[model samples]
Target: MPESLMMAFSWLDWLALGWFFACWAWYYEYSRRRQRSKRCLAGVMHGYRYDWMRRLLGREARIADATIMTHLERNGAFFASSTLLILAALFGLMGTTERALLVLADLPFAASSPSRLGLELKLLLLIGLFIYAFFTFTWSMRQYNFCAILIGSAPAADEKDSTPGLRKMFAIQAANVIDLAANQFNYGLRAYYFGLALLAWFLHPLAFILATAGVVGVLFRREFHSKTLKALAAGRDLDITFRGILQHEETTSESLKSQNK
Candidate 1:
């Protein structure tokens, strides 16, 4: 591209966008690996979820498992609806982007009014994030449905007892399905978290950078150092443990209890 086209926005704007993506990717990879071995929130919950399913082998009534899955599916459904609405609103802005750019041009800290192409690219970036979230959320819903099916199909304790090692295999498999669904849902929610930082771009590139840093800091603290992680770890009985960032099934269980009462 020629300098004329490139100069439609300041170098700062491009740098800020680049920096945000860099940080986003770094945090994702770091948290993913750390979750495997560390006592992070997600890892700990995985332990509990596994134990929960494992214990169900001995139970005749599995109302608790159904309620837990319902809560999770509801959570995913809410985000899926949100993403669809946001994407619709974003696309509606496409025709009026120039006018929005006009408004942006009047802002006190505006760098340079970007070209029509530039604004369209930014809009596409936002749309893309929401689209990703939508798929992730819906997929999570499907996975939760699969989890319910797995729970329903579980063999009775006496049946498993006769099979020696079969109970452990069944428990691990069931927990793995549930954990994978929750993981995708977390990724969708993380996109929303990063999307807030991206919104600062509409204000100013400097604001964008600061917002990205702030959001990342908040996320890092919640994932690695939050009191929630400690609480979950404290609640650990049996072999359950934790590792990182995301929360676990205890909240669902509590919510279920509240609703029942």
Candidate 2:
């Protein structure tokens, strides 16, 4: 809209910010489609999650599984609480927006001092990002709660033979729930990652562009080529024979259970 509303950022600055968000959206879609087949960590982890649910079928003691779910919930809770704290700090800083900008303006490298409206605009953007992250983390926590419930209701080892169809169905559902929660937690983390880039806007538009690119590049490399991915992939036997068969057998467990009779 109005230039005043736009703040210190020019059209190019706004476009760079848009580019930052666009990359996030693009990666999300690409990951959704290719995760199962690709070499990305997400795909590998998805396989593990699926395999985990299948093994739950053979296990009698579930305390370990419940413990894992509790850890996931705790992670989500930590991020959700952290986001709220940041949001509160943002509101507090909003009152001194102009005063803070004046201090920055004194610095030689600091870009132009923003108007009050401009300062407010930037603070509002920060607040919005935190709010988004808060919601994503909280939702992830809820999904983890649901995952716990699913685990509790999951079929037992002996019961797996009796109701193979139901076991497979529950296994798939549990894996999906866990995957969805993990995805949401990741989304919140992405928001935090991009928020680092947004901070560069306070310095200068060019810094903003460079910072955004840096953030995207860092994230891209981690997802596709990180040493962690390589380490995770290194368990080729587990990856191929165990996790792979775990997934395929779960699909056929329903029919095979009947054929055994």
Candidate 3:
């Protein structure tokens, strides 16, 4: 490569690194606010909001009663979006490290006679990253399909009074939401990982490692160390159970007092 071209490439690489960090920081802050809200809300309210949030994020954007067309539409949208993202990440990997290694072998380095070992290492890493991206994308797609199925099969309001079907539907929807949320979380983590790899194209590989560690640390905090997880794990369910009992007691007391009066 010419001196000017190499310098330009170097500058572009640094810019990409800066952009990656900026985006990651923004997401980190956003995730923090979300976690804080989860911690502050009561169990009933949290459960309610969890359902609402799932619907809001869903592609269908509305609850429907077991419609085939709706399921197909939502699934198609989810698959399309996830597939595109996966393809983009794969393209980036191919255009960067894989291509760079190809060029590097032709240059004069200490062990530069084809460097078959280094080439194989680069190929393996690229393949692994591609697989990660594919899995994240595909799993999110599958979860969205599950969400579609849940929404489609939900019973009508009229049936709520006559059967336990409605409750079962809501429970299924809740499980689907959990699956969607978990997969979405994984997808976000994969995005940060890919961003780190992109940064590695410009900065030292150590920068990639640091970025990965930072992303993982943030995930760990949210998943295990955060107040939200602690609250949810410790007493949220108990509080909910207690609240139900208290409501029942209050209703009974009020009924007895009214009867005496």
For each of the candidates, the C-alpha root-mean-square deviation to the true structure, in angstroms, is 9.7, 5.0, 10.7
TM-score of each: 0.85, 0.87, 0.48
Give per-candidate clash totals: 10, 0, 1
Question: lDDT of model 1 at residue 196?
Answer: 94
Clashing pairs in 3: 66-152
Q: List the residue pairs that clash in candidate 1.
A: 38-243, 39-242, 39-243, 40-243, 40-244, 41-244, 44-241, 44-242, 44-243, 223-245
Residue lDDT tens for model 3, 80-150: 46646665765665646656666665544312332343344444545555455556655655665665665
lDDT of 3: 0.52
Q: Give the TM-score of candidate 3.
A: 0.48
lDDT of 1 by residue, 1-261 (tens): 887557656788889989999999999999889876447878888888878887898888899878988999999999999899999999999989879889888988865655777788788899999999999999999999999999898987667344647888888999889889999999999999999998888888899999999999999898878999888877874333352212456777788999999
The better candidate by TM-score, 2 or 3, is 2
**Model 2 misplaced stretches (Cα beyond 4 Å):** 6-8, 236-239, 242-261
Top candidate on lDDT is 1
Q: Which candidate order results from sorting by lDDT in descending order?
A: 1, 2, 3
| Structural RMSD, model 3 | 10.7
Which of the numbered candidates is closest to the native, going by highest TM-score? 2
Cα TM-score of candidate 1: 0.85
1-261 per-residue lDDT for model 2 (tens digits): 776657556676678678767876887787678667547878878777887998898899999999999999999999899898899899999988768878768867656655667667778988998899999999999999999998898877876354777777777878888989998999899899989988887777778778888887888899888999888777644668676788888879988998999
